[model samples]
Target: MAVTLTDVAARAGVSPATVSRVLNGNYPVADATRRRVEKAVRDLDYVVNAHARALLHATSGLVGVILNDIADPFFGAIARGIQATAAEMRRLVVLCSSSADSSSEFAYIEVLRRQRAEVVILVGAAPEDAAYRREMAGHVRGLRAQGARLVLCGRPAPNPHTAAASVSFDDLGGARALASHVVSLGHSAVAYVAGPEGRTTGTQRRLVFAKALSECGVSLDPALVVAGDFSRQSGVDAVRRLLASGASFTAVCCANDLMALGAMAALREAGLRVPEDVSVTGVDDVPSAQDVTPGLTTVRLPLEEAGRRSLALAFSGHDFGSPVVLPTELVVRSSVVAPSAASARRKLA
Candidate 1:
């Protein structure tokens, strides 16, 4: 016979009501009593039917995780961190990808609300449209009005205020550090291959790169700066565009690892040797960075910690503040080096 709640109750010498409370993490039950019920369930190998339990209690012990794209390593790392934390807290997770589309994001929010998630975490890539920002904020407010907590893992839209909790990193500082480091290596004419200009990560990194170059008395050649979606192909194309513009850059800095890797491939095919011919650097030290031949010289951000902090804020019920900024360190690898005097002479010529 299948074990039931009554069986557990009988083994623990408590009412089924007490077992329900302990299992649901709902009502306050004495530690001793809770332990006894848990032990009985374990002894009987009894598992609460999640569907039945949710139907009875109006909650499924589920948390909703909404993201623009789960495939992005940065967001993927965040999701993994959230999953680890949720496992410890005995919560279930439901993942939804919005693909950076406002309609898709709003749709997922509605679905999560209808599903009765206790909390909703949104891993948004900054959206460009102001109307969409307002729409997203309104949905978040509605969820709060219905008593569900909302947290943003990445950059939420700017302008329309969101009272929701947020966890983010210092894109500007991290990008500036990477760019400044390259410029210090005597690369005065450096090209920037930026991600989508509207997204926070892309915009902040590009802006910081510009600022850092300016501080070093080097101006980014407008022809050498190209912005595209954060894809490997975009990186390759951006580099091609830069080369075709007749600008001589001893170094190229990409916004992300994918772009950096792509830039490397493009350079290799064009018979240019990395670091030897042109120094290259990328952001986000993704797993591929360590595996790629020559290894990537890039900036490493604490992506996993960003995810964990997002969950912590949700659970702690913390109020809104400036987004959390994580420290970024530059990883020196075979991809970057001091420009050769020969390359330097080319710039002078």
Candidate 2:
């Protein structure tokens, strides 16, 4: 039997009329009550006769894009590409920001599924949670079954055989190249500031960096590896903690440009010169990377191209049977240099 409004009302501890009003948005409801009703609906997997609505409308004329943080340059660039392609196709783009929260991400996916969007694009890294992955895989299959296409940009596909499409960057290779470059610069004592743990991007990058260091015969100091969110402030705090630990390091590698900028700021405040007193490097050579004083040496990923490719794949209506992997290039700037004798002596002291 289909789950009815009365079931949702009973689960939410509200009347059937209250549940109807909350779902229809035709009557005022308390925020708490609305949240309860929504949770009940999601928990029950109630679709409210979505198939009937699909038959009546036949077309949503909308494409949905889900992003972690729209303000971040990385995400913003991808959004620009997606929006441009969507506008050219005359399909309105609806953007939803999850702010890197798993619950919010799932909620946005559910909302897009209910609207029967023509295409749904999910951008950015996902948390490494088994349950979440399974749930997302189910959601992807559900959307496809409903005649909606799903595209993953900068995110890994849940199942390789699924109908969903994906476009991803070579994160591990980029991280490995960056770390190898720093190691070649004659800096053995290097500090790494990685993105948040449990995130695929951060985990893969950090793992590759460690492997590169090991291959170069340099042991990674646990004290020098700091966990940080992908933000300027987190980078700043990571550096401060490294300094307080009195770990001797001549180079600091950040997972992203924003954190690298923060690390540079902290180093300067501590009276250190870039690539002179200590070298600093970053990944994701964003637009600001070149503008920053003593430009940041980093890895450049084709973010906009990935976005465009994802949208194109969605419109093609054919599964390519494999994801499109974009290449990454190392951008050498003024941020990295050989350790001078003076800096080497200071590190020893």
Candidate 3:
């Protein structure tokens, strides 16, 4: 039979209530009495029931993180910071992957709520659909009403009335800076590799890139605009189709580092040299961005810092209706250069 608090109490010659107070540290017991209960617990190998403790406190000591994909390095870095903060607070951190699916995201949030999670953080960009925003607002309100901290990271405000804190990087600013850098190198004919259209990251990044290009008096060619799923494979496939379609471009700007790497691979296979034959750039200067051949010149986002800040917001006892925006920096590397004259004349055939 499993050792119980009652067993420890019996062994200690103290009432079960006194043992509970000593174990929980909720009530002050005499120093000698505390030491006796501790020794009895050790002797009996007694374990406190977490479920019973939660019933008493109404919280499970859990901090839940919902991310798009755990395997993706983008989410991995954020999870690291969240883990570090949760450890400092002595809270159990659980990462739930949503696979960027609305249904899965909803289900995970609901499950975490039912588990009585102390905090629930939804990380990364949100879909821009009105239906999704409305439904998610309801869920966020529900979690808040239950006294659970709700944090939205790397996303725009879903509802002003919902009690949720927001933390996000400047998606528009980063993409614009990335686009301006590419255009400044005299790459007028540019190809845009973007995430899915419905997502805020994909749709907004593409719009800002185009807007920055127009501001620079350069036009992003419609024929060269390729939609990708923000994956390495998506980058490869997008470039392959662009090449197959006989598109003319001197530069390709991708939404994220992984897709940029994939774009480089596809271009290399087609005998195109980065920056020499064609210039390439990306957003989100992830670790792999620097390690890859030729290096990726991209916008740097404070991903890990965003993670830590979300936890801080959760515990601040105040809700942030507007997002707490984090800053972004441009990292110049070996991947981008002035487009070569030869790049413009080269034929895909």
Per-residue CA lDDT of candidate 2, range 119-227, in tens?
8899988988888788777777667655788888887777666678889888778877787888898999999999899997788778878887888778778889998
- Score candidate 2 by lDDT: 0.85
In model 1, the Cα lDDT at residue 43 comes to 59
Q: How accurate is candidate 3 locally (lDDT)?
A: 0.83
TM-score of each: 0.79, 0.86, 0.81
lDDT, candidate 1, 1-349, per-residue tens: 8889999999999999998887767799876686577557645766678674444335456799988778878778889888988888898999998887766777777667657777888885776667767666667665664467778776754454777787777666776677777777778778889879777667777878788778778898878889967788888988887777767888988988999888998888888888788888888898898888788988888888887887778878574766666777778788888899866875666
Worst 10 residues of 3 by lDDT: 50-59
Give candidate 2's TM-score: 0.86
Global lDDT of model 1: 0.78
Task: Count backbone clashes in candidate 3.
Answer: 0
Which ranking of candidates, highest lDDT first? 2, 3, 1
The pairs that clash in candidate 1 are: none
Q: Kindly report which residue stretches of model 1 are placed more than 4 angstroms away from their true locations once superposed.
A: 1-59, 157-160, 345-349
Clashing pairs in 3: none
Of the pair 1 and 3, which is ahead by lDDT? 3
Of candidate 2, the 10-residue stretch with the lowest lDDT total is 50-59
